[model samples]
Target: MLYKLNLEHILFLDIETVPQRPSFADLDENSQMLWEQKSQYQRKNEITAEDFYERAGIWAEFGKVVCISVGYFTLKDNERNFRVTSFSGEETRLLKQFKQLLQEHFNLAKHLLCAHNGKEFDFPYIARRMVINGMNLPYKLDLFGKKPWDVPHLDTMELWKFGDYKHYTSLKLLAHVLGIPSPKEDMDGSMVKDVYYNENNLDRIVSYCELDVITTAQVFLKLRNEELLGRDEIKKV
Candidate 1:
């Protein structure tokens, strides 16, 4: 199935998120109580809610998306060229730009939104954030009433599982095992919150997010036994 897939039809994406507020104290009294309750399932008895707040990005309700980087493969001089772009900044603005991209370019029946662990994280987070930001859900993301086989989304992690629900794989590890170059020279998900709130470096975050997009597209291509994008073939926009 992967071998027959049209590379240009997939919008490979990755999102970077951070806590809705810089710190737990930033939340209002009502929100603080709510967060305390929400953190119960994931936090240990000894770990306070404030201490666990750094991980808020993992949950859509407690976090806001900061960056969404996407890429697609196209032919250039008879070779695959990867073009990467990013929508980043204030949560609403970033989401709006991404929505516009979907409505205008990727709004076709054959188009799909692909990501690593997207079905469980990136896809739902974007959909929920869109609704929260007072925007309508795009056609490719609004899974309402869609049949099991009709969802126009592809998850690289899910594809790697091959129906083994018990297995889990990280994108970085998959790339390493598959001999793809590592993109984690600077920072990782654990440091995104500090980098965004403390250091105030959206550019660095954007760079990291873009690397994930390229790595995701590379991993997908490798799955199909196809040649990966060359260094000179990656274009930034």
Candidate 2:
């Protein structure tokens, strides 16, 4: 299936999210109570909701997307070049900008939106976030009544699963096993919330997100038995 894919038509992407507020106390009274209720089943018995608040970023209702990094392949003279761009800063502003980019460039039958664990995390998360922000769903992202074959979203992680539903693979692990360059020489997802809230380092987060996008694209290439992109071939847009 991969060997038949048109790499240029796939828009590879990754996103970074953080809790909407820096701390649990920053949440309004009603919101704080709501979060406590939401975390009831997920948080351990010994962990209070306040102690578990840091994990809120994993939930779309309690989190906001801070960066969405994307990459695409272009073939020139039989060589492939990858160009990446990131939409960062104010959450709604970035989401709106990203939507426009998709509507303009990738809203087609041949285009796909690819990510690592996108079917479970990135894809639905982005759509739910957009709905919360009162934005119309982009054509590719919204799969309300679309048939399975009609969905344009692709997941590299799912491809690696090979029908082993009990197994899970991290992008870092898959890239490492495939001999693709690791993107986590610096901070990883665990530190994204702190980096955004405490360090005020959105540029750093964007860099990490973009690296994940690149690594994901490379992993897809490896899966397809295609040539991987060298360090020199990646150009930031």
Candidate 3:
């Protein structure tokens, strides 16, 4: 199936997110109480809500997306080129840009949104954050009543599972095992919160996110036994 897939129809993507506030104390009183309750099980009496707040980005309700990087294929002169782009800045603004991209270019049934573990993280986070920001759900992101096969989303991690439901693979590890370049040289998801909050470096976060998108596309190509992208073939727009 992967071999027959049209690369141009897949929008490979990755998103970087951070806690909605700089610190747990930054939350309002009622929100603080809700955080305490919502996080109790995950903390497991081992970590306080304050200490665990750094991980709030993993949950859509307690976090905001800072960057979304996406890549798609274009054929020119019979050579495949992958173009990557990103939306960054205020949560609402970046999301609106991303939504517009989907609505304008990738809304068709033939188009799909792909990411590493996106089914579990990137896709739903964007959808939840969109609604939180008072924006309507884009066609690709809305899965309210779609059948399983009808969902226009692809997960590289899910594809790697190959029926082993218990298996899990990080994008970095998958890239390593598959001999694709690693995208985590400078930073990682664990450091995104600090970079955005302390260093105020949206550019760094965006570069990291874009590399993930490129790496995801590379991994997908490898999975389908296609040639990996050459350095010159990846264009950042």
Candidate achieving the largest lDDT: 3
Per-residue lDDT value at 71 in model 1: 95
Predicted candidate 1 versus true structure: per-residue lDDT over 82-143, tens digit per residue: 89999999999999999999999999999999999999999999999999899989999999
Give each model's whole-structure lDDT. Answer: 0.93, 0.93, 0.94
lDDT of 1: 0.93
lDDT of 2 by residue, 122-229 (tens): 999999999999999999998989999999989999999999898889999999999986754589898999999889999999999998999999899999888889
RMSD of each: 0.9, 1.0, 1.0
Estimate the TM-score of every prediction: 0.98, 0.97, 0.98
Model 2's alpha-carbon lDDT is: 0.93
lDDT of 1 at 233: 91
For the record, the alpha-carbon RMSD of candidate 3 to the native fold, in angstroms, is 1.0
**Superposed model 3: Cα runs more than 4 Å off:** none
